[model samples]
Target: WFQQSESIIPNHLVSVPHPYVSIVKKCTPFPIEFVVRSYMTGSTSTSIWKNYQDGVRVYCGHTLPEGMKKNQKLASNIITPTTKEEDHDRPISAEDIIKEKWMTAEDWQV
Candidate 1:
């Protein structure tokens, strides 16, 4: 007989004991991550703020503010959903992401 090890468990895994596991429970794939940037200079904030001020709003299709400070907090932070690849982890505007089809128009509505 073999037993499963905790180290082999995936990070996203959530388990319930046999008696507690109910048939009514359902699992759904919610592929979404929300990222917010509040500080610039060495963070994602600078790039985002610069794009907004340059009239390049809408990264992928997300709208941003017209003008913002280097270290100023955003009126409302935005989200950038990226792929699982480490190289693909880069902050992008909603407009650019939407325009590139990385995100859908509906996704930007959030």
Candidate 2:
């Protein structure tokens, strides 16, 4: 999988210590994550399903339409942004990210 994805993304593979472990290069990580979903279902509290079931129409930044069922496929994919907290990640919007200076608008434009 790593070999196949090398062209798409840069990996931090340094050496394989064991079949289950590897030593990789250290790198600074971004403070946020973008979760793109084509379906409306998940098993976590921050999942779109949970939010929609709880009567939340807007999740992160996307507005979910009414009558969307669990596991139903969406017309298009949506990007749900979240903070990269160690203890627990939280849902966030793109505008909030920019406004809070977590990421610049120019960076987001990429």
Candidate 3:
């Protein structure tokens, strides 16, 4: 037979808030998502090039012109917006999103 000893006072109760709140705050919405492509490789990089071939002009909203050479760097950087449901999100190049009727345009700028 086994017996357990009782403590005179209960151990201190520690309260911890939900971790999701912190994650959500850290993922605050941005109006632009920048995609930097260095070179064309057989992996995910190739997929981007293929999209261009398929007439998908813009990869993340930076337009790619016809006859661009493989492994060539884009003329400029790309900025794509995150979907509204994902964060306080919004679509790319949407005037309403950029103007920020939902949240402050200043916050989205970052």
**TM-scores of all models?**
0.38, 0.73, 0.41
Q: Cα deviation of 1 in candidate 3 (Å)?
A: 56
All candidates: CA RMSD (Å):
9.6, 3.5, 14.5
Name model 1 segments beyond 4 Å from true. Answer: 1-12, 16-33, 38-55, 90-110
Per-residue CA lDDT of model 2 for 9-35, tens digit only, reads 777777777889888889766699889
Best by lDDT: 2
- Model 2 / residue 84 / CA error / Å: 1.2
Candidate 3 residue pairs in clash (backbone atoms < 3 Å): 33-80, 84-89
List residue ranges in candidate 2 displaced over 4 A. Answer: 1-27
User: What overall lDDT, based on C-alpha atoms, would model 1 receive against the true structure?
Assistant: 0.50
| Better lDDT candidate (1, 2) | 2
Q: Which pairs in model 2 have colliding backbones?
A: none
Better of 1 and 3 by lDDT: 1
TM-score of 2: 0.73
Worst 10 residues of 1 by lDDT: 1-10
lDDT for model 3: 0.47
